[model samples]
Target: MDVLVVGDANPDLVLRGDVRPRFGQAEQLLTGADLVLGGSAAITAAGCARLGLDTLLLTALGDDVFGVITRQRLEERGVTLLLQPSGDVPTGLSVILTPPGDDRAILTLPGTIPALRPEDVTDAHLSAARHVHVASLYLQPRLAAGLAGVFARARALGVGTSLDTNWDPTEKWESITDILAYTDVFLPNANELRAVTGSTDVDRAAASLVATGTTVVMKNGAAGARAWWPGGECSAPGRPVDVVDTTGAGDSFNAGFLAGRLAGLPIPEAIGWAATAGSLSTRASGGTAAQATRAELA
Candidate 1:
């Protein structure tokens, strides 16, 4: 395997246009609604597979309709699934409300999202892959608690590890330093970088993290992405595109960067690939709907 992705895998029910909720039994009309594959890990895996990487997604899912849909969508994208059964609990689900020209609000039921444990990622799994990427760290508490050890083990086997901790609802950015000690790459958005490092200045936050020997990749939305390492840094401007939905653009960017690194591209060129992939993903409604292929990224 070229990459092993560990994290959440579920279906996202996306509703667009005038999505703000009203109280007192008020009913609102929506412009569109569609159920599609989501979860940071799943989207990143799909993006890697679309980029021609041999990707394997290790996640927990229930035997439910949503689980079935998630499986089908991932398989269609050529991602190999390593299923972890979530006994009794239904699969996790997220309802994304995308208001016109505004940021989206997500309501999530973390049914199986937090089910994955450190033991689930066996030594065999780590040794088989050239790289391992973990996503949605806040959503998977059990795995997050022990991810440092997992990454350390991967590093011992000469495998690279990266992490993208999606938003933390608790607002407590804990245990990140330990994880970063073993992480080769750390991906985060501007807001998350500040939150994790407790520094409002992006440069300071990224530099602090880079001091620990891990590459810090900050996603700057329209401004594009920037990366900082011990002795160097690079950046790429975002590609211009008509964005339909910004659901999984960041995750796609993570995939592109990792894919480029695995393929021996330099940090600056990889940032270009990351920006292009992220911009192209927003061309459709869902996260994976308009994800770029290898040719498209080229």
Candidate 2:
């Protein structure tokens, strides 16, 4: 495998147009509703595969309809799976309420999202891959607790490691510093960077993380992306696109950036690839619906 992605795997129920709910036994009509593959790890893996990387995803999934759908979608996107069955719990699910704007709301039922543990990532898994990427850290408390050790092991095995924490539902961003010490790349959006570093300024937040020797790559929505390392920093402007949905765009960006790095591209060029991949993914509703292929990115 060229890349190994470890984290949550589930389906997303996306609803658009007039998605806000009203009380008092009232019902409203929606413009569209679609069930699609979700989870940050899954999306990132799918994106990497689409970008021509041999990708493997290690995640937990229940033997439920959602799990089956997730599996099928990932396979269709060319991502190999290393699934851990979620015992009696149903597969996780997220209901994304996308209004007629960029901002949206997500209500998640974390049935099996927290099932992955550190022990699940064995030595063989790290040795088989050139790079390892972890996602949705807050969703898996057990895995998060041991991620530092996992990354350390990957590093020891001569594998590069990256992390995308997604969002912290509890709003308490904890246990990140230890992991950064072992992480090669730290991927986070602007808001998440601020929340994690407790800094209102993006430069300060990125600097704080980069000080730990991990390269900090930040996603800034329409503003594109920026990267900061020990001795240098660079940025890429956002590509202009008619965005239909912003779901999973950042994950695609992560894939593009990693793909460029694995292919020996410089930071500035990798950031350009990241921005292009993220912009192209918004051409459709779900995260994987309009993900760019390697040729498209080229």
Encode model 1's per-residue lDDT on 1-298: one tens digit a residue: 9999999999999999888899999999999999999999999999999999999999999999999999999999999999987889999999999998848899999989999999999999999899999999999888988999999999999999999998898998778889989999999999999999999999999999898898998899988999999899988999899989999999999999988998999998898899989999999988999998878877
lDDT of 1 at 95: 99
> How high is the CA lDDT of each candidate model?
0.93, 0.93
Candidate 1's displacement at residue 6, Å, is 0.3
The RMSD of every model to the true structure, in order and in angstroms, is 0.9, 1.0
Clashing pairs in 1: none
Error of 2 at 225 (Å): 0.5
Q: Model 2: how far is 25 from its true place, Å?
A: 2.8
